[model samples]
Target: MKKFLEVAEKLAHEKPLGPKYRNRRLVGNFKGRWECHIEPGWLLVYLKTDQEIIFERTGTHSDVFK
Candidate 1:
């Protein structure tokens, strides 16, 4: 999970992640949140605000979304 932590740390600092992470804003019911691919099938979802960055979930696409 080291890579995941690294990405999380960057996010907590409000730093922009590289394109390899495929980071993007979420929409639909998940609006206001953000998602990024941590690996081939792994993903991280979180919400960021001025005060804090709230990690929502992390898992494979199906694992987290389903």
Candidate 2:
């Protein structure tokens, strides 16, 4: 989970992640949230506000979206 934490730290610091993370806003049931790839299929879902960042979930695409 080191990679996940690394990305979380970056988000916490407002640092831009590399393209590999594929960070982007989400829609549908997850509207207003953001998602990023941690590895091939693993993903991290979160929400960012002026006050703090809220992590919602982390898992493979199917695992998280299911």
Candidate 3:
């Protein structure tokens, strides 16, 4: 599959800061949008410029990650 550069850059540019355990690694893309994977199997989805909602992916956690 093709990697979405826009989504990748957006996810990289906007990151939630913290003292420890940066959650920024949660970044991913879905349905033409850039999303973040927070919990073990939950996707924290939203538009690039706003907050988001938790969701589920159809594939295994590892498969959907990349």
User: Which pairs of residues have clashing backbones in candidate 2?
Assistant: none
Candidate 2, which ten residues in sequence have the lowest lDDT sum?
A: 1-10
**Candidate 1, 1-66: lDDT as tens digits:** 899889988888878999999999999989999999988799999998999988899999888888
The TM-score, computed over Cα atoms with residue i paired to residue i, of candidate 2 is 0.94
Candidate 3 — what's its lDDT?
0.41
Clashing residue pairs for model 3: none
Please give the distance, in angstroms, between residue 34's alpha carbon in candidate 3 and its true position after superposition: 1.2
In candidate 3, residue 36 scores what lDDT?
49
lDDT value, residue 51 of candidate 3:
59
Candidate 3 RMSD to the correct structure: 11.2
> TM-score for every candidate vs. truth?
0.93, 0.94, 0.27
What C-alpha lDDT do the candidate models reach, one value each?
A: 0.91, 0.93, 0.41
lDDT for each residue of candidate 2 in 6-54, tens digit (9 for 90 to 100): 9989999999999999999999999999999999899999999998999
| TM-score of candidate 3 against the unseen true structure | 0.27
- Cα error, residue 55 of model 2, in Å, equals 0.8
Cα distance off (Å), candidate 3, residue 40: 1.2
Query: Per-residue lDDT for 12-33 in model 3, tens only?
Result: 5664533232234333345444
Q: What C-alpha lDDT, on a 0 to 100 scale, does residue 34 get in candidate 1? A: 93
